[model samples]
Target: MNSDEIKTGEERPTRNKWNLILGILFLAYGSYRLYQKLQIPDDDNFGMILAVGFIFFGIYDLWKYYKGV
Candidate 1:
């Protein structure tokens, strides 16, 4: 394809709405995991860590959306 066509076909990251939806989903999943961890009788250190990581990633996505980066 020509350069102009290629440039036109390329999507700007900030224009993608799925990023925001995915971020919200990640946040929700993290919260759900945390709740599950709390309900478990045994120690859930791994679950807690994973939940924290998910939450952080979600927040970072949100930040990126806001910053348009």
Candidate 2:
């Protein structure tokens, strides 16, 4: 394709709707899980680790959306 035919900027599609939705869901769930863990006396390392992972993944997905990736 010719350079003149190439698309750029606004011509490109924005982030997928589903991606944003999933990211938001993940963030909310992870935050809630973390809070619940903190409220209880039980100290489960695995739960905390998973919660942190989900939170980070959600953050990453949101960041990707902003970065237009």
Candidate 3:
């Protein structure tokens, strides 16, 4: 309880490695989808939506990991 004391294992928030990796993968997949869509003008709106969703969730995961939220 000391002001200068540091929190140990159980008291500290731990980052989820799996979440981090998933986030990275999601981002990569989203980017790839977007790129493919750009290369094909006939791409459907669904593709864009999926890409955006993936990117958004990926960013959310990374944010949670880094911000400990």
The candidate that wins on TM-score is: 2
lDDT of 3 by residue, 19-38 (tens): 78888989889988888888
Whole-model lDDT per candidate: 0.80, 0.83, 0.83
Q: For model 1, what is the alpha-carbon lDDT of residue 10?
A: 45
Poorest 10 consecutive residues by lDDT, candidate 2:
9-18
Question: What is candidate 3's local distance difference test score?
Answer: 0.83
Ranking by TM-score: 2, 3, 1
Off by over 4 Å in 2: 1-13
Compute the lDDT for candidate 2.
Answer: 0.83
Given candidate 2, what's the lDDT at residue 40?
93
List ranges where model 3 is wrong by over 4 Å.
1-12
Ten-residue stretch with the least lDDT total in model 3 = 3-12
Give the alpha carbon lDDT tens digit for every residue of 1-69 in model 1: 777666646465664566687789999999889888888886869889999889888887777776677
RMSD of each candidate relative to the true structure = 6.0, 2.9, 4.1
lDDT of 3 at 63: 84
Question: What TM-score fits each model?
Answer: 0.71, 0.77, 0.76
Error of 3 at 5 (Å): 9.5
Give me the runs in candidate 1 sitting further than 4 Å from their true place.
Answer: 1-15
